[model samples]
Target: MMKEEVLSVLVSNHFGVLTRVTNLFGRRGFNIKALSVGETENPAFSRITIITEGDEQTLNQIQKQLSKLEDVKKAVIIPDDLLISRELLLIKVSADAENRPQLDALISEYSAKIASQQSDCLTLELTAAPEVLNLFIEKMRSYGIMEMCRTGSAALALGTQTVYHDAK
Candidate 1:
């Protein structure tokens, strides 16, 4: 069975690092489902969160390959139980006087923020788990979606567990 895995990588914050990492995945024929990268607490390093689907052996190989990269300091698969993740979504939906009330109620139910509104459309912002965002997207479809953008998932390990470089 295919399993979704999240790999957190700690790497030097330098130019071309992201390209090299992504290229590695492409060369191995692995499809990245989602990817998010940002500077870590220490400015010299960055954290990369990658979501992919594959069998156990494939996941292990991907982790090993990521660790072999020059800029990568640490790479580890964060177990789902120990992972805390969220994604940001911005959706624009058609809205007029007739359906505005119902749309407002739906937005309130999802805790989505009103980013903007116009006579013809309303833009809403939501930050939540991937599954929640997916459901919200489906709900908006009925209201006639104009456009939407979703960011890749960003995650952290629960409690004290963390992926970090050990240069000692």
Candidate 2:
């Protein structure tokens, strides 16, 4: 059955590598829900975390195709049972004198921070699991969110496992 999957890919940290990976998804007709790429511990390589939807067969094909790419070293699904993941959000909400304290208290309750503040609005910065961020968004809707930016989820296998380790 087709279902959501998170993939961790290790690739050469060079120009065109990101393009190549994204193209693979487009070529295969798979929709990418979210993608994040950054340099790994070794500057020579990069780690990409991708959230997509596919079945077992499609996922297998993705793994094989990614491994065949010149710049891709490995691609493996990060099972929720063995994964640790988070996304970052920066949100600006309307906060006047009457509601400022309430917003501040709500932010503190969630361990979020006020990145900046103005007479009419307050910007909050938070890093947490996607679900937590969603709940925050839902609660803040009543306060009138002025703007928001989110960094798509990035994930890693829990414990000592490395992204580059060969999956068997």
lDDT of 2: 0.88
Task: Point out the worst 10-residue segment of candidate 2 by lDDT.
Answer: 159-168
Every candidate's lDDT: 0.91, 0.88
Taking the tens digit of each residue's C-alpha lDDT, what string does model 1 give over 14-35? Answer: 9999999999999999879999
Model 1: CA > 4 A from native: 165-168
> For each candidate, what TM-score against the reference?
0.96, 0.93
TM-score computed on alpha carbons, candidate 1: 0.96
Report the error of model 1 at residue 166, Å.
5.1
Q: Alpha-carbon error at 137 in model 2, in Å?
A: 1.2
Instruction: Provide the lowest-lDDT 10-residue window in model 1.
Output: 159-168
Q: Number of backbone collisions per candidate, in order?
A: 0, 0
Cα deviation of 54, candidate 1, in Å: 0.4
